[model samples]
Target chain A: MILAPQALLSAQQQIQRDLHSCLDYFDLPHPLKDAVHHAVMLGGKRVRPALVYASAQLDGDVMSAAARRAAVAVELIHCYSLTHDDLPCMDNDELRRGQPTCHVAYGEATALLAGDILQSMAFEVLGSRMFDTADLPNPAIALRQMQLLATASSKMVCGQVLDLQAEGQSIDQSHLENIHRNKTGALIQAAIMLGATTVLPVAHPSFTHLRIFGQSLGLAFQVQDDILDITADTEVLGKTAGKDIQVQKSTYPALLGLDAAQVYAQQLHDQALEALQQVTGNTQPLQDVTQFLLHRQS
Target chain B: MILAPQALLSAQQQIQRDLHSCLDYFDLPHPLKDAVHHAVMLGGKRVRPALVYASAQLDGDVMSAAARRAAVAVELIHCYSLTHDDLPCMDNDELRRGQPTCHVAYGEATALLAGDILQSMAFEVLGSRMFDTADLPNPAIALRQMQLLATASSKMVCGQVLDLQAEGQSIDQSHLENIHRNKTGALIQAAIMLGATTVLPVAHPSFTHLRIFGQSLGLAFQVQDDILDITADTEVLGKTAGKDIQVQKSTYPALLGLDAAQVYAQQLHDQALEALQQVTGNTQPLQDVTQFLLHRQS
Candidate 1:
C-alpha cells in the first residue's frame, strides 16, 4: 500500500517539471499570472501525474517526453478543476491542500479566470510543440486523448455543481456515487486512460483493461478522500478537515459512515487490482498505486 | 452580401444534421439536457459554422462532414460560456440571443451542469463514432483536428474569464483585442482551420489561404460585434444592448468611442477581403461572407 521509494521520487520530479512547463508558456495579465504561479507552487500530491508516469513505465521504460506530456496535461486539468472548485460560487472554501485557495488568495474573479486560463493552457500544452516532440506517432491519437481530458474535466465540473446542490439535501447512495464519479473518478480515469493512449498504438491491447482499472481506482480514491476529510487532521490533510460536513456537502463517508466507506473503498481497490490483472507484464507500480489509494491517511 | 441561395441552404441543413447527431449521443440528466436543447434551439445566426462551410467549399465540395462537426462544436462552446456567464457570481444576466437565459430557464445549478455537459459533449462529438465513420486515410489528421478544436475551446473559456475581469475596468485597445481574440476569434479561427484540415486529403494544394481568410474575418467579426453592442438594440441584438456600457465592460466602442469602433471594424473587414484576394479561384463565397460579416445588423 505504500509508494515505493524510487516510484515516489520519480513521480514527484515529473510533477515538478511538468508543473513548471505548465506555467512557462502562459501570458496572463499581471497579478493574475502571479497568482496562478503561486497556486501551482502551493503543494499538491501530483498523484494524478504520478499515476500516469508510473503506469506508463510499468511495462518497460517508455519515452519520458510522451509520459510527461500526458502527465502534465492530466495535472493541468486536475489543477484547473481545483481552482474552480475553490471559487466562491462553488465550494467557497478559504483553503485548499494547505494553502489559501486561489479565490481566497487572489479574489474570486481572478481565481475564476486563473482556472479558465489554466484549462486552456492545458489543451495548448497538449497540442503544442511539446506534443510534437513526443513523436506521438499519430496526431489523431493525441487529439483523442485531449478529448478524453475534456470529457473528464466536464464531469468534474458537473460533479462540483451536483455536490454544491447536494449540500442540504438528503441524497441517497446513487446520488453520492454520481457526485464522486464526476468529481474525483472522472479525472483519475482520464489520467490513467491518457497515459495508456500515449502508447495506444503500441499498447493497443491493454486499453480497455487500463480504463477499467482507472475507473475502479478513481472510485477508491474518492472514498479515501472522504475518509480523510473526516478522519484526518487539518495539518495532515492540509485543508480544513470536516469541512465537507460543515458545508453539508455529500461524501462517501458522510453517506456510508466511516466503516462502510472503508469497506467500499476496499472493494474498489479489489476491483481495480482485478482489472490490472488482465494487462500483461509488470503491474507492481499499479498495484502500489491502488494500495496507496486505499491506505493513504491523507 | 448574402448567403448565396444554395450555399446558405446547405449550410443550414448541414448544421441541423450535426446538431441532431451531437444531441443523440449526449446523455445529460433529464431536465438539464432538455434545458440545453431549449437554449440551443433558441436561435443565433449559426454564423461560425457557416463560415467553416463557406471556407471549406472555396477549396472543394467535400467538407460537409467537417463543416457540420466544427459548427456544432463552436455552438456548444458558445452556449456553455453563456450559461456560466449568466451565473450569479459572474455577469448575472437574464437573457441571451433573445430567450430567457439558460440559468433563468433552469435553476442555476442545473444550468451550470448543462453547460459543463455541453462543453464535454462538444469534444466528444469531435472524437465520437460519428466523426470516426468510414475510417479515414489518416486518423492522426482527424486527431489533430480535434486537438485544434480543444485548443480553441480552451482559449474561449480563458477569454470568458478575461471578459468577466475587464468589466468595470479601464482597458486599452490591445487588451480589448486580446479579450475578443481569445473569446470569439480563437474559435472562429479554429472553425476555418478545421475545415481546411478536413478537406486537405481529399482536396490538394489545400485551403491554407482559406484559413488566413477566416482569421482576418474572425477578427473583423468580433470588431463588428463591438460595434453592434453599441449600435444595435436589445430587440434586434437579442441580448441586452448597452449592457456593455451598463457593466463597464471593455469593448472597442467603450475604449475608442462609437465612431472609432466603426472605423476599426471596417478596416478589419477591408483587410479581410485583401487576405481573400490571394485565393485565385471563386472568391465569390469568400467575398460574400466578408461583406455579410460587416453589414449584418445582428
Candidate 2:
C-alpha cells in the first residue's frame, strides 16, 4: 500500500509546478494575484492533486496535459473551498497550514474575491486551449470534467451550509454522514472521476469502481481528520487544533466514541481498497493514496 | 428597433420556465432549494436570456436545447452575483428587483451558499445532458461556451475586487473603466458571446462583431445604471437610490457632470449600434435590447 517515496515526491513537485503555472496564466492585479498565490502555493498536502495524478496513472504512466490540467483544476477548487471555509462568515479560523488564513493575510473582501476568481479559473483551465496537447483537446471530456467539478463543488457548498446549520445542534449519525459526504466526499470523488474521464470512456466499468473507491476514501479522510483534530496539537495539525470543539461542531469522534471513529475510518479505508478490486490498470497509486489518507497526521 | 411586444414577452416566459425547470433538476433540501429559487425567480428582467434567444434566432427560428440552456446558464450566474453582492460583507443592500434581497429573506450563510450553488449550477447546466440535442452535443462548443462564461465571471469578480478597493479612494477614468469592465461589462459581453457561440463559429466574422457590440453595449449599460442611480427613486429603481453616493463609490456622474455623463452614455450607445453593422443576423433584438438598457429605470 506504500508508495515509493521518491516517485511520490516527484509527482507532488510536478503538481506544484503545474498549479503555479496555471496561476501564472491569469492577468490579475497586485494584491489579488498575491492572495491567490498565497492561498494556492502555501504549504499543504496537495492530496486532491495527488489523487488526480494517481488515478490518471491507472490508465498510463505518461500523463497527458489534460490529466495535468485536471490535477491543477481539482487542487484549485480545493484551495478555493479552504479559503472560503476559513472566511469570517464560515469557519473563521485565523490560521491554516500553520500560517495566516487568506482573509487574515489579504483583507476579507480580497480573500472572498480571490476564492471566487479561483473557482472561475479552475473551470477556465479545464475548458481552455491551454490544456490541449498533440491529440487535440477532447471537448466532450472537457465538458464532462467541468460538469463533474461543478457538481462536486455545489455539493461541497451544500455540505458547508448543512454544517453551518448543524452547529450547536445534536445531529444524528446519518445527518453527519450526509454533511461530510457532500462537503468532503463529493470533491474527492470528483477528483478521481475527473482523472478517469481523461483516459477512459464514460461508460467504462473503471469509472464506476473509481467513483466507489473515491467515495469511501473521501469519507475515511473526513473521519481521520476528525480524529486528528482531537488527537493532534496545534503545531502538528498546522491549524487551530481543538477549534472544532471550541465551536462545538459535530464530528465523527463526537458522535461515535474516539475508538469507534478510528474503527469506522479503518472500515471505510478497507471499503475503498476493496472497491479497487473491480478496477483495472495500475491501482497501486490509488492504494497508496488511501493508505496515506488513513495514516495522515494532519 | 423595438421588438414585437408579444414576441419579447413570450421569450421572457420561455426563459423563466426553463430556469425554473433547471432548478427543479437539483435534489437540494428545503430552505436551500427555496433560497435558490427565490434568488432566481422572484424578480428582475430577463435581459440576458432575451439576448440569447435573439442571437440564436439569426441562425434559425427553431431554438435548440443548447441555446435554451445557455440562456438559463447566463441568468444563473447573474442571479448568483447579485445574491453575493447583496451580502452583509458586500453592498449590504436590503432590496433587489423591488423585493427583499436573498440574505434578507434567508440568513447570510444560506444566502452565501445559495449564491455559491447557483454559480455551480450555471456551469452544470452548460455541461449537462439537458443541453444535448439531436446534433449529439458538440463537446467543443460546450467547452468553448464554458470557457467564455468562466473567463467573464472571473473578470467580473476581479472587477468587484477592484471596485471594492476603489471605494473611498480617488480613482481615475481608466480605473473606473477597469472596474466596470470586469464587474458588469464582462458578464454582459459573455452573455452575448455565449449566444453567438451557440450559432456561430469561433472564428466567424460575426463573432468578432458581436463581441465588439457586446463590449460597447456593456459599457453603455453601466453608464446608464450610474445615471439612473442618481436620478431615480428607490421604488422606481427597485433598489436603494443614491446609495452609490452614500458609499462614496466613484461613478460616471460623479466624475463627469450629469449632462456630460448622459452624453457619454449616448456616445457609447451609438458605438454599440455601430458595431452591429459588421454583424449579420436578425439583429432587431440586439438593437431593442440596447435601447432598453439605455432607457431602463429599474
Candidate 3:
C-alpha cells in the first residue's frame, strides 16, 4: 500500500506553509526569527507530521483547521526535540540532515533560545483556535490536543533521561524498550491521537485501534533507525554512520543481530497493519507511512 | 499596602503544595523527578505565584481552582526559565538561592531535560480542567491562561536572545527597556493577567488598567533586580553579587547610576499603584504585593 507520490508531497507542502504562518507571528526584528526559521525550515523526513496527516486524511483533500493544527504542532514538537538533543551537553552533534545543527548554524545561546521558543510555540499554536466556528471541538479539542501533546512531551523528556542513564550500562531488552516507548513511541501515539481527535471524539472506538497501530509503528520506526545506523553509510544516513556503535549506545542490532532486527521490524510493520484493519477509515495513508518507516534510508 | 506576613506565608505554602502535586505525575522511578523537584522546590521569593493569587483574590481568601492553576503555571514557567538561564551556555552561573544551580547539582543533560519537562508540565497543568465542574472557566479560562503563558514564554525566550546579543555592547535606555519588557516584564505581566483572567473575563475593563499595572510592575521589578545586583552582598543575593558588572550585561544600575536606578524603581512602583487604583476590586492584595516588590531587601 505505497502512498501515491502526490499525497506525500501535498502533506509536505501543507506542513511547510502552516509552519511558515506560525513563524510570521515572531517575524519582528530579532536573531530568534532567523534562528527559528533555520531550525524548522531545514528539511527532514517529516515523519511525525506525516503520521498526523495520514491518520487524519479521511476527509477531503482540503485539510480542516483542526487537522492543520495537529499537523503543525506534532512537527514542531519533533523539530524542537531534535534541536535540544543535538546540544553540546547532550549528543554534542554538529550536523543534522547533512547540514549544520542549530547550535552550529546559530550560536549555542541562540540555538538554546530557539529550541525553548519552539516548545512554547507548539502550545501557542494549540491554543490559537480562538476563531473556529464550525463543529470543531472549538476550545475543547484544543485542550485535549494540548493535554496529549504535553503529556507525550513530558514522557519524551523522561525517556531521554532514561536513555542518558542507560548509556554505557548493561541493561536488558525490556529496559531498552522502556526508553524507546517513552522517548519515541509516546509522541508517535500522540500524533495519531491528535489527528483522530481532530475529527472524532476521544471516546470513539477508533482511538483504541489507532493507539495499537501507533504503538506498533513507533517500534518499527525506531528499530529501522537502529538498523540504519549499522547498515547504511554516512551520506545516506544524513548523519554520521555507526554513531550508535561509536558512542556505545545500545541499539536493536547491538541487542539482537542485524538480520534478527530486520525481521523484528517487519514483524512490527505487520502488527501495525493488522491494528489498522480494526480502524474504520481510509487507512491506506497510514499503511503507506508504516511501509515508509520500515524502508526509509535516512 | 504591604502584604500581611500570614498572607504571604500562605501563598508560599499553597504554591509549594501545588508544585509538589504537579511533580507527582513524573513520580515514577527516574532521576528526572528528583532533578525537577530540585529545580522547582528550591526556595526563591515565590513572587510570581504570589502575583497570581493576589490578582485573583477578588471574592474570598480561599483560591478557586482557576486561580490555583494560574498560580502554578506562572511559577512553573518562571522556574523553567531560571533553570535554562543557568545552563553552561547561558548565564553559566553555578549557584542560585544559596544552592547549586540545576546544572551544577544535577548533570547538565539532566538539568536540560528537567527544564524541558517543567515547560510541558506547565501547559499540562493548564489543560488539566477535565475534573473541574465548577463555574471556573471550565476550559475557556484554561485556554486563555495557556494563551497568556505561552505568549509570555515565547516573548521571554526572545528577550533572552536579545539580552544575550546585547552582552558587552553599548545599548540605549529604550533598547534595555525592550529587552526587559520582553524577557522579564512579559512573564510578570502574564502572571498578573493570568490571575485576573481567572476571575475576570477577557473583555473586563479592569484588564485594561491591570495591563498597565502589570507593565509598570514588571519594569519596576527588573530595575530593582538590577539595583540589588550592585548594592546587595553575595550571601543576601543567594547568587554572586555584582554578576551584572562581571558579565557587562545591560542593567538599570549600569545604564543609569545606582541612585537614579533606585529613583526609577520608585517612580515605576508609584505608577503601578496608580494604575491599580483604577481597577474596581479590593485591590489591596495587589497593592501589598506591589509594595513588597518595591522595598524587598533581596
Q: Best candidate per TM-score, number?
A: 2
* Candidate 2 lDDT over residue span A118-145, tens digit each: 8889999887766454554688889889
Residue-level lDDT tens digits of model 3 in A14-112 = 788878887785543468788788889997777788888888874434557777777788888888899999999999898888988999988888888
The docking quality of candidate 3, as DockQ, is 0.74
Considering chain A alone, report the TM-score of candidate 1 relative to the true chain A. 0.92
Query: Which candidate number has the best DockQ?
Result: 2
lDDT of 3 by residue, B1-298 (tens): 2344667778889898888877775554467788888889997889999999999985456678878887888898898999999999999999899999999988888888888988998888887752256543466777788889999999899888889889999999999999999999999999999998878876999999999999999999999999988888999889989899899999998888989999999999999999999998778888888888898878
Model 3 misplacement above 4 A: A1-4, A59-61, A129-137, B1-4, B129-137
TM-score, each model? 0.89, 0.96, 0.95
CAPRI-style grade of the A/B interface in model 2:
medium
- Write the residue-wise lDDT of candidate 1 on B219-248 in tens digits: 789878878888889998998888877877
Over the stretch B116-154, how does candidate 2's per-residue lDDT look in tens digits?
888889998898867454554568878888988999989
Give Cα distance to truth, residue B61, candidate 2, Å: 2.1
Candidate 1, residues A115-152, lDDT tens digits: the string is: 65566566666666663443543566566676778788
Q: Which residue pairs come into collision in candidate 3?
A: none
Point out the higher-scoring one by lDDT: 2 or 3: 2
Candidates sorted on DockQ, descending:
2, 3, 1
